[model samples]
Target: MKNLQPIISVESDAKMSKCRTLIMLISPTLVLAIIPIFLSFIIKKLILMTFLIFFGFSSLAMSASDIYFFIVILLKMRNNELFYQEDNKIYILKK
Candidate 1:
């Protein structure tokens, strides 16, 4: 008799490792925070500093929303990659 077996694999986007994806997703907010701090060094005017601070803080809402949608998109794409065959091994698809 001969033994037959299939190989299994997990698939994901090569460019989007979990850490990198999450970090890249959230970096906009981080950049928003950084801008205000940088401004304090170059901008001596307190009024303008205060305005930029508010603008940065307000922009976080938009960035947070974008991140949420991106996470949803990633999850959907990942779910789509989960393909299986009725064999001894499974294969995953990556983008």
Candidate 2:
């Protein structure tokens, strides 16, 4: 008699890992916050340092969980990555 069994394999590529790392860093809130700062610098010549200080302080005031998520989104966006859902599975794609 011969034994028959199912073989399962997992393959992770650097590209996928990078995408995940990016997604973990850039959260939605961070993107929204950053947009205003960008506009302020573009339209009013406000100093970036000042905007950064204010952004940091405001983010710090949020709950730990919210802050974490916000940072995750920001990092992802900075890296030109985004997350999508398909068939209930989450996927990170590069832009």
Candidate 3:
């Protein structure tokens, strides 16, 4: 009897490079998500802390929206789909 399971090594340098790229791309979003918690830990003033928390969350929301737009555009480009706009909405055609 012979072992038939295939093994793939992700420890190769090329695979590590891809892993690093993924971490780099995702770290900003992860850090932004944690900013509110970090602010709470550092700020002791109730009023200023509230403002910082508000702005931090607002910025996170804006960043998330931008990420969504970027993903949509990337998908459209990769799928060879045409994007159109109507009433502030985006429409993509199936290719």
| Reference-based TM-score of each model | 0.43, 0.27, 0.38
Off by over 4 Å in 3: 1-17, 65-95
Model 3 poorest ten-residue lDDT run? 9-18
Question: In model 1, where do residues sit more than 4 Å from their true spots?
Answer: 1-15, 34-44, 67-95
Best by lDDT: 1
lDDT to native, each model: 0.58, 0.52, 0.53
- 1-95 in candidate 2: lDDT tens per residue? 45432243223343334446444445434564655555555655457657765775565444355456556655554456655544425577776
lDDT of 3 at 83: 45
Distance from true location, Cα of 17 in model 1, Å: 0.9
Q: How does candidate 1 score on lDDT? A: 0.58
Q: Estimate the lDDT of model 3.
A: 0.53
Error of 3 at 32 (Å): 3.8
lDDT of 1 by residue, 11-68 (tens): 3434444445556556766687657656756887989888877777776665765478
